[model samples]
Target: MSLPRNLCHGTLDEIVERGGLTEVTGADGGPYLELVSSAFPGGQAPVGEARVFTGDSIAKVVYVGLAVPQIGLDSHMVFAFCPADVAVPHFTLDSVQGQGTYAFHLDLIPRADLGTHLPYLDWAHTPLDATYEEVESRPGLMKTAIGPRQFAMMSPWMLVHRAEDEAFRGISDAVKAYLDHWFSLVEAGVPAEVVADVADTDLAARDARNRTNVFSPDVDKVWAQVERLIGHEQTEAVRGLLLDNCPPEVSA
Candidate 1:
């Protein structure tokens, strides 16, 4: 299996094991399964698949993958968001293999603004500093060209880069370290001092806006590529699921 697939499925399994989450049914009142398109306009088979689960501390765990192996485009993404009541950072990963190049973005999306929340920043992200620096300094892991606005939505510790095969394979340890640290935070909960007087409603509102902006096409151009393969409607449908907002298509 490719690294992206392995890491995606593996981390998903771990999340389910710990969270005991149940998949949320679609309007069909059945399991959520989607076949986005049989093939792209160019005749290559394209798959835009999603599975969403929710329960316990996790409000939603969204897994979406798009693949057109004929063109060497395979992107697997996962976002495990905690309920609004808690200030724990959400887990996220986007691993991609495009036209002989390997790239991945990994981070724990912040629920509180790291710049102002010193305790939260130190508790949630500072531990990963060494690992982040190590991976950033790796010889073949060159930084991806991300806009400043998109970077603001994620943490400073996010690992996003294009890598040579060796560097790509070498990232496993760093990925493990990040995941393990996150699992610990989930189990231990954020220090009370970190959340402090922040209201749960405020956290919920900020998270809603953050989720929407993080995936907005204005900040992230990758949605354009997805729209090209899956069409605008299906692309928005997927976005709707990620945002935990309304479905794009629904009856009154």
Candidate 2:
């Protein structure tokens, strides 16, 4: 009955199956990265599970689900980071349902600077304009304010909003469209002209810096909540897991 949870799980399964992704076991020798806490004031414990995968074209794929039903909070997020060899944008989706509130964030995180790489922008993002506009126009959905710096890190085509239950569920089609487009980009490989002179090391370095900025506490306030729920140590571990990839670290 929870649309966000269902969508996240389904997407995770499909990607792992079709992409030939290999699941990475946690430090506990468990299959998933788990977090549990009883930090809530009313004795409510929040439980979270994070699944990580790796594949040839994708450096890392993370699906995280957290819920504290007593407080009416539930969130699901999926992030697919592209390999350094290609300049394809990373795919991300976030869906949340809370008491009297529903929200989601969908975006393709760019690997190159879109402002300067006009061709890359066109090739990776232009096709989503129609779908973005359509989703924006849906009834009972309204923009959820995000910081300017956060916006600068993500693509202009991102769909982030709060919506009614009906409007929230209506996004399944748009999610599918975006996922299909991303998959195609990964499969077809990046056009050489789109990133003509950039070396693989440079691309990897850029991606690392970008991920740091995007997930930093200053840029994403949600980390505070996560830390509270899972403790500071575990929270940082999760962040590191999300940021870490198969690419060798580019030397300074």
Q: Tell me each candidate's TM-score.
A: 0.89, 0.91
Cα RMSD, each candidate: 3.0, 4.0
Report the lDDT tens digits of candidate 2 across residue range 8-96.
77777777787898887766656466777768665635488777888888878888888877668889999988885578889999989
lDDT of 1 by residue, 119-208 (tens): 778898999999998888889988999988899999999999998988887887887899899888888876777768344338878988
Query: What are the lDDT scores of the predictions, listed in order?
Result: 0.80, 0.82
Candidate with the greatest TM-score versus the true structure:
2
- The model with the greatest lDDT is 2
Estimate the TM-score for candidate 1: 0.89
Local error of candidate 2 at 76, Å? 0.7
